[model samples]
Target chain A: MDSSLGGILSPRAIRDDGASMRLTRTIGLAATLMLIAVGLVFLRAEQTRLAKATLALESEWVHLRGERWALQAQVARLRTPAQTRGRMAIFGVALDPPRPASPRTPLSRLALVP
Target chain B: MNTRVDVTQRRNGTVVLVGIALLLVALAGRIVHINWTLHEKLTGIADRQQSGSTIIPHRRGLIFDARGRMVAGSRLVPDVFVDPLLVGDVDALAQDLGARLNLDPGKLADGIRARAGRRFHVVARGVDEVTAKAVREMRNPAVGLTMRSARTYPLGASMAHVLGFVGRDGVGLEGIESWHNEHLSGRDGRRRTIRDAARRALHGVEGGAVRPVDGGHIVLTIDAEIQAAAERAVENAVAQFEAESGVAVVMSPKTGEVLAMVSWPTYDPNRFGESTPQQRRNRVVTDPTEPGSTFKPFLASGALADGVLSTTELIDCGMGRRYFGRRLVKDVSPHGLMDIKGIITKSSNIGMGIIAERMGDAALYDIMRRFGFGERLGIECPGEASGIVYPLRRWTSMSAASIAMGYEVAVTPIQLAAAFSAIVNDGVYVAPRLVKRLLTSDGTVLEQRNSRPPPRRVIPSDVARYMATELLVSVVANGSGWRAALDDYQVMGKTGTAKLPFADRKGYEPGAYLSLFMGAAPARDPQVVAVVMIRRPNPSIGYYGGQVSGPAVREILRETLAYLGVPPDGTVAMTAAYRSRPGL
Candidate 1:
């Protein structure tokens, strides 16, 4: 028993409550879908960034390994007998003179079981 | 008028509806066509444009000695490039690079200016680590550095012939490198990735990824110390005799493990371009020459094993000369009468010729084959030459006499050494092996599960012992191999002074001789066999093997035995000979 102004066209008819409810539900569903799509895109981008970072780290480690091998090659070249003879002073500083096999007699030390 | 208006309106509405309906049908047809036909093609085109892949490079393997020292290695240097347009402060960058790389800054600037429109211009290759680090630290957007590998021979010319050089594109070109290339250079992997608008890899799967496997490692049986001694000895012999070329081998008689193998005219693999083609050849395993009297011991072994000659039976050498058919063969020295043992000890050609003719061609050739002649020994070396022995059909009247005295047949140095190793190993022949083991990148040892050869009997143990004691021992004691005797060790050996063919492969090359000495140590129970061959030594300094290659063998055996810790079995006599007569 609500009051009305017009004879046939009243405020209750103008409201159209069912249609409004339907429009609100459709908008809410569409907005939720849009949020989910944006979240998936961001997740993809983050994954790419992390993958690139990991590859960069691995490449650095590979580089370090390569450098270590190169340095070792150089050291081997420097330690050859001919090189040692040429640069005796340099190796003499790092290496001690020959240690005596034992404090006892030389023949005893030379005597092996073979 | 009202009725006419109604009919016109109806016609107009019908026409408009029909047109609208047709347009709607066309739009639906177009949508279906796009979904069914064009979708796959457009998607394929997009994928081709957006995704890419590249090979992940793997480093080549290294060669190591038995003691785990690096003989051949690879260094990962940088291949530096630059984007000429994007490079800023060109003068400053050029100066910095020039200082680091030892180049002229002015020339570098001019080179960069020439590559005006190029995105990538290679500035330097094989840039060392320190320079590469300095360039990277500059952080210039234009400067790009990619890793490249260059081979390195740490010991230079030490084992250059064995550990060969690599080619321009990082493939093995020679020596052990080429033989074990598949094992040395592992399979390269690939990285398939998608890129964004800025062309950065998203690291996603387009197809799939394969993990790269690094090359397997190789360990040789050669000891670095013993190899050095052998190399020095050969160098000294070549210098002393002024020989054209020389080869030397130190092998363990028991296992046929080659301790040291050396060839003169060796080239450093690092600077492979500086040497001539002649210097690059590994004559030890590749070159076969006519083995003169060194072939006599095999003949004696054959004669005894076939029961054609008794150990005590005497053959008259008759002043060192013997005639067969029309050819007169002469020995190095004169011997009147000798047993089979005496013939070997004296290296008498006539005695050997008579015994060999009695044995005939088939018996001699069968014995030769049993001793591993004219066939490749499969020593894991590249370019091994299978020696030449004429077949039965090719034999002439002089063939038996020639073959009997160690001529008409050519043999490689390694073949002769291994043959004598059988005599030293108590009549059992084991083919020589150079590669000790193979290891994976992760330290897993790979066994040669297939390539091992079984030991074979050549002569009986009694005949071999007699040969080692009577024939070989006497050679060192008083024969042509007298100079090869060591003071502390019991030396047993033979000598060969062979005439070489002319360069045209015709008759003998006058004044050219191949002086060779083949011997084993601790003659009573031989442990090691050393063979030295000096090609075309100067006649002025004496071209006899006992003189030319003997001293070198002496020094080499002394060093190798000491390194192996072989105790002196003849010390009492050795002390009298060498210990300065300490009590005198």
Candidate 2:
């Protein structure tokens, strides 16, 4: 009677069930590894995007510096004595440089608040 | 029949399963071999495909005058270049680019075709910002722009010989620019980055990257206003006299600071290529000439200092001519007997020859050396000439008399000015200073104080004061330098008219002369010493130093004194100061 009952729960059936469980575990680990790899790829792309933005800012900064220097140079050129003289000659007006304030200068003259 | 079919099917299924297992094992082995064996090679290939590098350009320093006005500066301008290998439809592209850049299309096309194998060809350098923007907006892969600093002299030719011009390679070629090139050319930097597939820099790499340090800024002691005035004065003199060239220099007696230095026939630094080499020479420090009567004060100073001649001593003028060992010493006019003061006042060559004889050659040479003649004076300029002064051992019999009358010796205008400053500065031989301070890009200030030798006492203070205040004053007051007199100030100076020597040093050139005047003003305590030198003026207009350069010196001193806020001699306080001084 006991042998007949053992025959009902066969060793082949246990082997089949164990094979199915092993397959399920293998598929689960592989999906987890795939998720981690895809996450890393997205992180790398985001990092590259940030770096590109930084590079753009750096390029803009350099350009602004160059522009600032060019403007300063232009201002300097205009301030040259030769340029001033040419302008003075062209305008036919004599422009005397304002005298620097000295100890002798009156306070009212310096204030210019008439 | 059924039993036999089942047995065959089971054997075939077993064979198929074994075959499938062998294939899977072989695929796994191949994967292992690739990952382990070819790892380093493949990784190297990937790194090379995803790496980029670029140079971070460095900025050159600026040059400013004493008033903080920009004399020489630099700006980042774009250099246009083309990649011939990458250009498409070369003729069409060249036409399009040439139309925008004002270049000839035929030449541009030829240049591109000729350089087809090369990666880069320079189309233009230092393009203006607007042109650079136009090129950038072209959006063509073949065209590119690189930033480079272009040096600009804002004051143009007015400050050319002093500030100088920079070369195409961004190196200084002359004057102060050349002397301070290393300090002006800052270090360049480099950057390494990781790139994407499109060759865009994705990230800066960790190692082998450097940041650039900017160059130090140079602040010159030149006052821009005074420099302009001096330049205008010199230009006027040159034009009025129809001279070959001219030079004017103004310096502070107390600080040895060069306030203004102008060399005429000057080339504009912005357009230096259009000028000749002669126009580019800085004659103030580079060319030496005989100073003629301008040298008499030093001779007189040496005589008085050595007790060789008294202030009241009388010497025979021999009626304007005397012979010293076959060399004839002649005066401008006949004078019978004159005191030491009369000799200087009359500018009698025979009288100076007698004084030279009394004060031997060695003593005279020593005094000239003490007065900073025949030496470089170490001013901040390139190609400075250490003027010619023969040693006592090489002195001919007539050399003493020749030197005494300002011959057989050479002195640059700067050297003469520095020597005269010794008299003006109360006997101190202070070195000429062109640079006042050097400010680094980091905001650190480096004062140029005590960089060279310290000031030395060249003569007794009393002697220098007496010479500067009394004798020189008398020269402008009652002597050859009379043209240099100013109505509002007591002008003190001497005039010189030296004949130009032949190129081979054989003899003087007829009808060619260097008219020179060196002077200081307000007389009691000298503030500024100015030297005006005019070369090869029209003899018809007048080549005398007192007539030509004296008036120029008078103009310069007048403007310089007024600019410096020095009170006029007519002021009661100024007159009292002159009266209270012991030496005067």
Candidate 3:
């Protein structure tokens, strides 16, 4: 008689009830889909943030590049002959015509000596 | 009580159904109206707002001299614009900006006021960064700044004719700038971006964008220092002589590289518009002048080559005057009997007439054609004049005599220089070249130098040597070009003083002479071939090529040769610069 009662109240038979089993299966799937949706939302937010950051950086890069070129042009302008002649006043001496090397102690002779 | 409760429930259900139906009808009506009636207007608005693309202009090429000095380049500058809708205190703002930008305050104010009812106004097209920075500091809501690139010529008008200038639309207008405009102007880029209500680019939303490719750089054969030296000499000579114009060319005879070319009454390329069209013209490549006595050597070379004349053959100059084909041919100075060599040395017009008479027209024409005269010579620069060369059939009885004495033909200064360079280059002609190479922005060489044109063989080397040694060498040593002599350097050159023709092209203009000095240094193995020409100078200052242009050539050549450090040849005391060199 006890064996018969144990068989009737077994864990497998209680799990076989269709109404409760269906409810648990449906809940598990809904929870899984909800988690996946939550993950995707976070991923999209991160991607947008990165894209916006890259755009801002690119714009800044263009601005800085233009600035660098302008500075280079200015530097080149200052190095010109006209500018050099105009700015020679700080040295308190005028630029004279360039003189040639001394023939008495010639560079060719010096190079040949050693 | 149950019946009354059922009735209340039924009434509430009916009211709820009615409310739901009304909401559905209104939503459907709105959808139909928008799709059918308002499509075109909304689409147009959307296009104006979102479809427009912004251009990213490509930077124009940079021009570098032989020594890698930037002569012409582009720089990014701020262009000032205004939104009249957002403007405040236009006059006050104009005054504030005028002081910094060097603009007329009244003009700015007037323009700003005139722009009323307009949303946008170009206050200033291109402005320096410093002025733009000041404007930004003011933080005026009305003012807006856009970046634009402008061509900058740091050396100003030093090589303006070659470097050329950019138009307001950033296209090359003349010189190498125009010839290589395709390579100099790189492809512009573009991008699509979302703009806000204020039509400002949204940096957050980056979309389709094409990055600009900066233009290639051009490397010229011109040496900046040598160019400056040549220009200075020409400038001084022009001013001192009070001449209408002057041009000087310094070239490497072996390579046909034009190291320096200068024309007087020059204007700064920085302010190219202020220059007259005449000043803007590169006369070395454009204007052709009759070569006068310089034609003597080429004719001599031709005669000697054809065995029509020998080195020591004596010809009577008839006391500096002779009748050749009913024309009274006279020399600037009197001469008696002159050999082929003495003819060039004394620049005897009568002597040349005799040589030309013997050589005839066809052979002379063929030799001149080989010498690269009366032809373009096909240089890298633009606007080259071919000069006037009559056909063999067109030669008159007097044509040969006139041609021999450097008349009845016109030749550009560069053509004359290159032709003389041929004589210096061992009787071979090489076309004059300006640019050495073209380089990409990243320094990749896009185009190497132009291949040398086929070598033109004009005269035999032995004849060329005799002309260089016996004839041209004497011109500087003891002849008309004596003023161009250096104590320790053998100079081979000719002096030419030709009469300018009248506007009517009828007869020559009196008292208007074009004085020219062309020569090569260390004549034994020539290096630099230089030419100096002064046009329509005041006769009082001096009009003779020997006096006006020779001394100038000597000084220029002395400086250039010193800079070159080429060892001297002649047995004489050297200049300080040459003497100072390490070895004697």
Candidate 4:
């Protein structure tokens, strides 16, 4: 009975068991915190890249819209009849009347109706 | 032994410390150098991204008439290019493109093969809208299209001279385009993008764009309808008289604004290269010819203004000719004794010489100068001539006689028109201008051009009125300009048939004459002044200004008055029926 009590209260045994428990808990907490920090850093870098791309696209879009407006205005101004006639006159060209059809007799016109 | 061991340990420790210090210093220097180099490279990249890669082409401005109708403008077109290196099956590709684009398959294959290593080659230029659409839909990876603006003359040949033509790169070559090139050419912008090493667009760099500025619009003072009428008149006269060339100008007497200026043999701006340089000349402003009898009115005006001659004063024009110092000044018909009004009406050289002698050369020259002769009309055209008006000191006795009869003096059609305007416009000489106003892109007037201030009174109001009234009688009575008389309007005009000077100085060409007619309508209060010149008309047509060119002027004036809704003068019938009646 005395030997049994001595084994149960052994100092080496108690020391070894306490040391294993402390080491395991420290390793587990350290690994979890490291993973959380890495994930947050990756997410932040991706958001920054997307914001930069979006800004560049918006600027390009604005520039294109301005060019479109200028082209539209030019087209609208070019397609008009009065302006066309004025330009032709500068070249000293005059418009001519359409050619008249040949005269047909009344009897010939009636025969064609049949 | 113990001391030796301790000393060796201390020496080793010192060596280790020195090596670590040297390594740290080398590392710091390399790091600083790399950081500075990176900063410089980044700055260079930013600058290149902002300025390089894409180019912006300048666009030509639009030209519009007074009614805001477009005459000349720019239209967007596509330019096609091919990447020769990327093209596969050259023959097959060439055949397909040739059939669709109307190109020779062999030529396409040769061109593509010659530029084998090149990334791009121009396959076609100025493609039509339909062809451009087809090209875009082709979806061929090797082909690319870039949009560019091209100059278009919508009115074709009508507005050619006024609107002018542009080169392939859209630079104005003549007319108003050449005159106002700087204002019409807009600034180009650029779009810079970040590109990979292969020159493929990666992404648009931050702040890498410059917007293009559009050219300002030009509004002409000419009314399109009036211009068309004037053009028709000139064209008809040119064709009818078989004249080598002709010109007509209509101007507002009050403001000297050119409403219609026409020149025959003018080329279509749309096809300028197809015509000859002689046809391209703006004869109204560029070519100067002898004033012929049209100059008689000015001589008459000067004499009347100086009180040297009265309308009723009789002058002797014995027979049909008179000898003045070995020079013969001939009259169209023999006049025993004629009044001042009769001398102008008959266009008598002998009678005019007698009047010119009383006025003296200095007085006549001064009057001509004051009327804007021997000077440019200050028009907007580029190549305007200053008509020849020699100084009185350069004149001989014969020079005075010849100048009085519309000889030895040269004047442009425009100058003649302007001078006639002064005669009818209360004697105020104003410079002629084609540009009425210059506007910004958004219809804001940048500058409003006003008529030039009158330099000096060449004639008094009464004398101007008297001369104008007499000219009106000449148009209706037995004057040469009988055909120019309007049916229901009081036509005031003068007829001039002056001999053209030969290059050989053989006095003057006998049959070769420049027929001219200058007049204003509604005699009492003139609104418009027209001058017409027909050069080298068929002698068989009896090349008289009153006969050949007068009818054209009448038609133009009638149409112009009707178009402007001017009411007809009821007094025309009485004026037309009234005979010379000696003094009446």
Top candidate when judged by TM-score against the true structure: 2
TM-score (chain A) of candidate 4?
0.49
Best first by TM-score, ranked: 2, 3, 1, 4
In model 2, the clashing pairs are: none
lDDT of 4 by residue, B1-584 (tens): 98998899888888888888888888888788767767788776655433234545545667777666667776656777777866878998888777768899899899999999876688888787688777777677666666666676765666566666777777777788888887788876666665543344455445666766778778887666677788888889988988888889988887878878888878877667798878778888788888987898888898888889887789999998898767887776798798887888888889988888889888889888878888887787768899898877788878888888777788999999998988887777777777777777666888787776544466888888878876545654558888888776788898888777787876777788888888788676777788888888989976989888898888788877766666566444547455635564
Scored against the true structure, residue B201 in model 2 reaches a CA lDDT of: 68
lDDT, candidate 3, at B425:
79
Write the number of the candidate with greater DockQ, choosing between 1 and 4.
Answer: 1
- Writing each residue's lDDT as its tens digit, candidate 3 over B156-252 gives 8898887778888888988888888878888667766555555555533345788888888999998877788888888888889899999999999
- What's the distance in Å from true for residue B186, model 1? 0.6
lDDT tens readout by residue for model 1, A1-114: 644523223445546656676567557657877889899989988887777776566567667867878898988887776676567765565322333232233676677635
State the iRMSD of every prediction, in order shown: 5.1, 3.6, 3.2, 10.0
Per-residue lDDT for A44-100 in model 3, tens only? 778766755666676676678677777777877888766666677666656544544
Question: Which stretches of model 1 miss by more than 4 angstroms?
Answer: A1-45, A78-114, B1-55, B81-124, B130-143, B192-209, B448-451, B571-584
Candidate 2 clash total? Answer: 0
TM-score of chain B of each: 0.83, 0.88, 0.89, 0.85
Identify the superior model by DockQ, candidate 3 or candidate 4.
Answer: 3
Model 2: per-residue lDDT, tens digit, B529-559?
9999999999999998989999999988888
Q: What's the TM for model 1?
A: 0.79
Candidate 4 at B370: error in angstroms? Answer: 1.1
Q: Candidate 3: where are CA atoms >4 Å away?
A: A1-49, A83-114, B1-23, B32-55, B83-121, B137-143, B197-200, B204-206, B571-584
Provide the overall lDDT of each model, using Cα atoms, as 2-decimal numbers.
0.81, 0.84, 0.81, 0.76
Residue-level lDDT tens digits of model 1 in B1-584: 98999999999999899889888888888888888889899887677656645345566888887678888887766888876866777898899878877889999888899997765677898876788888888677667686666788899999877888888687887788888887888765666677554344666563456666778899888777778888998899999889999999888888888888899989989989898888888888999999888999988988888899998787888886779888898876788778876787778889989999999999989989998999998887789999998899999999999887678999999899999999888899888888888889876888642225788889999888878876787787767888988877888889888988888777998899999899888776677888999999999988988888888888888877776767666734633353242221
CAPRI category for model 3: acceptable
